[model samples]
Target chain A: MISKVGRHSIRLVSELGELAGFSGKASVALPGQRHIMEKLTRSIFEIGVRCVPITLIVGLFTGLVLGLQLYYVLTKFSSESLLGQAVALSIILEIGPVFTAIMIVGQAGSALSAEIGIQRNAEQIDALHTMQINPIGFLVSPRLWAAIIAFPILTTFFDLIGIYGGYLTGVELLGVDPGAYWNRIYEAVSVQNIVNGLLKALVFGIVTTMICAFQGYYTHLKSDIPGARGVSQTTTRAVVYSSIAILMFDYLITSFQMAS
Target chain B: MSEATTLKLRGLKKAFGEQVVLGGIDMDIPLGSHTTVIGKSGTGKSVLLKCISGLMAPDAGSIAAGDEKGAPPCSYMFQQNALFDSMTVEENVALPLREKGKAKATEIKKRVSDLLEQLDLTAARKKYPAEISGGMKKRVALARALITNPEIILFDEPTTGLDPQRKYSVFDMIRSYRKRFGFTVIMVSHDVPEVFEISDKIAWLDAGEIKYWGTPDDLLANPPEDLKPFLNPQLSPA
Candidate 1:
């Protein structure tokens, strides 16, 4: 049992090291990549524009549910006026970044992983290498850059839509004063809070995109199976690992922010 | 290496864990010649080609260009064609030049246009790989391979899944292109007698080594004893 654990630990470390190196190489290649703006624009269209509807929908529903739940709880303590403050903080500090990331992972990240995994299986990556082209630059760098630029913007959209949904539930449905809801939210959510939330979005974006790209890029080497099955395995792992990384980083960043 | 040689492989070796692939391969490929390496499945023919193409590093020995400027410019045509499924034929064909970023847009456009027309792929230039027929895909792959005008081209099972007619057509395409471009060709193929038609020389790889290296006629007339069963399965004793 100990040996098995040790083996797994070593494998995890090795994979992490490889992931770090892959991320560094892709980041370094971005500035020098040919036709950078064109690739970056395409990637933004894929990861940002295509993902807008889902983000708005999920954000709206999350706010409604939070407002409904927190309304009843606050009424028990005669603190129903705090509904806006509660909803705003929860959406900004946690739900906005996390759920937006999860939604993007489901919609865009999976497709990216699968596309790259299939490319690896087809020897397209090897063909690039033979042509004296760096596959990481051609494939991953633009997506990374897109994630960095898009995630914060998407999270901002989510937070706004979610706050409005909370107003719809807290004031329109629950018969709370609309002025109180707006006033509490206005006073409670500081610039630092928004900055902190955007920071989380940026981190989540980089981590998730890197994980997804790494899994697909090394699908052949990392997977025990071969061909289509191998691509499928790595893509599944990409989503699962990215989700876990999001939560883990959420905790670490939250803790660090609180400490600071 | 003589001036006539394009590639010189001396004691090339590779292994995956305990299974040795190319134990120690030695061969000299003549300039502007088509040399096909034939072997049974899992015999490291592709591995040797990968090593020579620098896709995979050899565990031992040296693969040297005939001229002493180090490795020659080379392109690979994978068995699956390896065309970027997302990119149209024109984009796929022009990718290498675009990535290299040396040529201006006009030069790249002119080269891609000329090659696509030469390969009869002009009509399919805007089509994705999935939109084209197998023969057309092969032609597109060849166009992409030749777009760079490299001194050497490596083909790994260039006709693996094709019907007999398509296989022959692919061989003819390779032969005609090799003649037109004057590039050295190193192909790994399983198609036996069909491959012989386009090959200037045949190298039979077995058990991680080249067992026979000679002209097609020599291989047919006096194939090595172990290679006979592979070359002519019907003639071998049941």
Candidate 2:
């Protein structure tokens, strides 16, 4: 039993090593950067344009709930004016990056994983190899780079919509003073705070896409069986792993923000 | 045909964990000749082709080409007709040339157009792989495989799932290209009679070794007792 466990552990470690190597190669630019423009455009549309409505809704609801909940709590202490600072801080420092990434993990990351897994099952990746093209460079890098470019911008969009959502709930619905809400939000949220959130979004984007792409690229290496079922399982695992990475990295980035 | 470029494989062995797939296979593939590798499913005909093409390394063996310092010049048309779904048929065929980056854009486009025209795939040039028929995809794969003009081309079950008409067309295409380009041909196929008709020699692989290697006529005349069953399955069953 111990030997069985040991063998499995060794296999896992080796697979992780392979994934790291694959991602390292993908991070390097390929020879034909101009050629990847098509891929980049497709990925940006998938990760950014298609995801906007969902991010907007999630961000708005999150801010509304935070505003409504914080209003009641702060009112108990008669410091209800702190609602704007709380809402702005929460949206800029935590909710914006984390929520945007989770939405993308559900939307774009799963699609990327499924697309690549299908490609692997269909032997398209092997065809790339036979043609002497680096599959990582041609297939994986553009998506990774596009996600890195899209996530921070998406998070910023999320923050703006969320702060407005907070305003709609705090001043109009809950009867908090509009001047206090706007003034506190403006004074409390700095460029550094927004930058920190964007940084977190950028990191989350890279890590999530990398993990998902790694899983898709190595679907065959992960499973013994060959078919749609194996590819589906790998895609499912990619989404789960990518979501976990985003959350874990969010905590790490938050720690850095606190320190800085 | 160009002077046959000989590819020699010595003691080619491959294994997956405990299962030994190819146990020390030794064979010579004469350049400019079409050779079909026949074996039962999972008998490693495809694996041998992959090893020959450098897609997969053998566990213990050497695939010696004329090149001393570089990899053997070879291209493979995979069994599945692994065409990129995102790209049009013309793009798929032009991929190898594009990846090599040796030819200019106009040169690559002209070569791709010429190959497509020869394969009768000019109409399907703008269509994606999914939009075309299976036979067309196979031809596109063949075009891609031959575009590199390598010393040898490896085909893995080129007509495995096609209808009879498509299968014969693939065989005919292989025959014509072998004559036109003079490049060596190594194919793995389950379709015996059609493959044998075009093959200069047929290699029978069983139990991870080349059990028989000779002309189809010789193989039929005094067939090895072991390969007799594969050579004439209907008669053996009767």
Candidate 3:
């Protein structure tokens, strides 16, 4: 099963590289990317802006759980103060970005894939080609840049809400002083840590969008063609491929950091 | 309609791997003429159309327009109406304007609105492709073709899967549109009689060669005994 999953991951990346290869060359300006800005703005409104309330709720509950759980474990060492650092590190470095990426993939990524795949299968892509418009520009670039911009914003929200939840659990539930807890959190969570987490969030964004778009556009037997089942399959493949990719990349980056 | 003046094909050949689709085709379409090329199911008719539209390039031979070297930018209509589902009917219709030259939004809208109304699709101007019928989709395809006001427009099997009356209506639309715009129409069709009705000339393409190229009148008068079986049903090859 592990080997098969690895192969699938490689297969997906290979497909994406091949499909977007043409665009990479046809593209004159990486900075001149047109649709990406619009995509980022729209995604910020939809995924980041609209998702704020839910993200806060989820973040708060997650922080509370971490604090409560760590309280028991750290009690053995009489290290209750570690609660702040623990919660901060977990939320900032790991949970926040991963959780949010998974969420967006479920919400927007798969839907985008299905829609584009169906358009491709339906011959709308071919129609665009006939007219000499790049399908990647017309479709893929916006979604990619949007995710890159939007994920980091959402991850920041996740981290903040989670820290607040940690505060609630550390002060209200535990006998820790509220003043002490806030002080520890502020002192323990440095700028470098926050930046690291944001960097991860940005990478996660690119991965989620690229894998979804690539899977959607290339999973089909051919391009510029449309069918209902073909689109469904495309959506399914996109979600699966992206989820696996996120996990694999997480492992590689984390391991690289550890080794370094 | 084979005119000697515009859109000439000389020894056009296309191949996929070793499988040659169009071995060699030589023909001339007159200015503002409708010539329907008829053939059996897989006799490279669509490939020939694709070559003319620049959708597919020929391996050898030249496709020229207006007694010149390069083809004047032409429009192609697919067998499937390749409309952008994300865009509305009017937006889809006005797409060619973006390609030819940038036009003011107001001007593009006006041109799109006129085409939509003419096709009797003004009611569904805001509707998506999924909201419309196949016939309407075909008509939208027609609208998109006419949008660019291309010098040459090629339709790939224009009336495939329509009801008989709708097929006739599409055929009639093809005829009237050709008359109105005065652009050359090179269409691929199975409806031989219908093609004969609108086509100024007909090319009987069989087994990768043109058996005959002449006016429709000449075709009826000198119908090949061998092709009669393929042209009409309930007939056997001689």
Identify the candidate with maximal TM-score: 1
Instruction: Give one digit per residue, the lDDT tens place, for model 3 in A81-181.
Output: 77888888889988998887777788788877887787776667767767766667766766666666788888998998898888888878887777767
lDDT of 2 by residue, A1-260 (tens): 99999999998799778878887888895445446777788879989999999999999998899899999999999988989999999999999999999999899988888888888988888888777788888878888889989999999989988988888898899899999999998899999998999999999998888888887887887756667887788888888887888888888888988987
Which scores greater on lDDT, model 1 or model 3? 1
Q: What is the DockQ of each candidate?
A: 0.88, 0.59, 0.41
lDDT of 1 by residue, A1-260 (tens): 99999999999999899999999998888887889999999999999999999999999999999999999999999999999999999999999999999999988899999899999999999999998888999899999999999999999999999999999999999998999999999999999999999999999999999999999998988899999999899989999999999999999999999999
Q: Which pairs clash inside model 1?
A: none
Which structure is stronger by TM-score: 1 or 2? 1
Two-chain complex of model 2, DockQ on C-alpha atoms against the true structure: 0.59
Per-model TM values vs. the true structure: 0.97, 0.94, 0.86
Interface RMSD of each: 0.5, 1.9, 3.0
Clashes of each: 0, 2, 9
In model 1, the Cα lDDT at residue B36 comes to 98
State which candidate, 2 or 3, has the greater TM-score: 2
Model 1: how far residue B96 lies from native, Å: 0.8
RMSD of each: 1.9, 2.3, 4.2
What lDDT does candidate 1 reach at residue B66?
A: 54
